[model samples]
Structure formats: structure tokens, C-alpha cells
Target: MPFPHDRPTRGSDCDCLPRPSDTKGSDAKASDPKPSDPSPSDPALPVYVLRYQDAWFGMEKRVTFAAADLDAALAITEREPIGAWAELSQDGVLLCRRGGEPGGAADYWVVD
Candidate 1:
């Protein structure tokens, strides 16, 4: 199916309008169908962005990842390490790391 942008839309529903078969832009014969994309669809994993500094460039580098969560992102970074000081962002939102193992929530702050 042709995208709305590739072919003019029909109406408010935004359906692709079919091209005339008898003409080429109403001039000559029509051509073959548009070729479909061969690339795979987007990953289902949760999106993550790792923020780190580059040692060579001495500038910050942002690396995006599609994984289960921050833990999964960290695992990939461990294999192909980015930088010593790095932070993780999930779905484009930056997240803070938990200081310790799971215990009581008393040490943390809360709002009403």
C-alpha cells in the first residue's frame, strides 16, 4: 500500500488514492507497484539512552538502546563499555540509579 505522502489522500480518513491505470499522470501507460521496505520493524524492547563522555573527543556521547530496562542496557554497556561515568535513560526519560539493594523505603523522600 502506498503511504499518504507517496500518493494523494482520498478524504478526511487519509486513505491513499489509486492512480489511473490507463495513463501515466494521465499522459501514457502506468508502471509497476511501489517497492516495499525490506528493513525489519522497530524493536519491541523498552527504549533506553545511555549518556557518557568520550575519552578521545572529551565530549559527551549519547548512545540509544532498545532493551528490557536499565539493567539490560547496563549489561550491553558492560560488554562494549562506553565510559566510566554514564547514566541511563528509559524511553527518552533519564532515570536515577538505586543506591542500594531492595530494603525499606524509609530512607527515600516522598510527596503527598
Candidate 2:
């Protein structure tokens, strides 16, 4: 069947897929509309520290802090006594060990 614009159908001997040369006079995608999503560059996201427990039934330590990103979260953790006390997370996503390690987690965090 032919396309709405009368373009050739694929696999029927002729295909109307846009070619490099056909893009010279106009840009179809550039003229189309699209819904933009929030990017890392957007300020909608913010780093947060999620406070949880290392062990469910132990008083060894109280809470944990996971940085939303590698920003102030990790930096603030440097001065904190992590390791077995609390773990780190970013953007509500837990990172590193669950029970906590050196407390100095990685920058493995992302934003929408």
C-alpha cells in the first residue's frame, strides 16, 4: 500500500524512506513538535539524604544518608562517620553496600 503522501511502501519494490539528499531542502523532524523532558541541566531535581537503618534489630547505629547526587551529599558524608553506621544513596536510589562500607559512596546517581 502507498503511504498517505503517496510515497512508495517498503518491501514492495520501492521504499520512500527519507534519503540524505532529500533532507537538503527541508528538515522534517526539526519542523515537528515534541514534548521535552526534564534533563539533568534542569533544576527540578535536588539531592537528598535518605536516612535508614544498617541492621533492623541492632542499636549499633541509627540512620543512613544517601546523597541524591555526588554533590553535597558525598562531600557532607566525608565529614560523617559512615561505615556500618549508615549507607549512601542518590535520587532516592540506594548506592554502594546496603549495610554500609566506607560511607564514602560513588557518584553513581542520576536525575530525570
- Candidate 1, residues 8-96, lDDT tens digits: the string is 45434553554444245564334543344221224656777667655466577777767665566667655433433566667656674
Q: Each model's C-alpha lDDT?
A: 0.52, 0.49
Off by over 4 Å in 1: 1-43, 97-112
C-alpha-based local distance difference test score of model 2: 0.49
Candidate 2 per-residue lDDT, tens place, 1-112, comes to 6454565455344434656656798745775655465343446555445443334454444344433355655575555443344555555666543343355554232332
Q: TM-score winner among the candidates?
A: 1
| TM-scores for the candidates | 0.41, 0.29
Clashing pairs in 2: 66-89, 67-90, 68-91
Which candidate's lDDT is highest? 1
Q: Model 2, stretches more than 4 Å misplaced?
A: 1-45, 50-71, 83-85, 98-112
In model 2, what lDDT does residue 40 have? 39
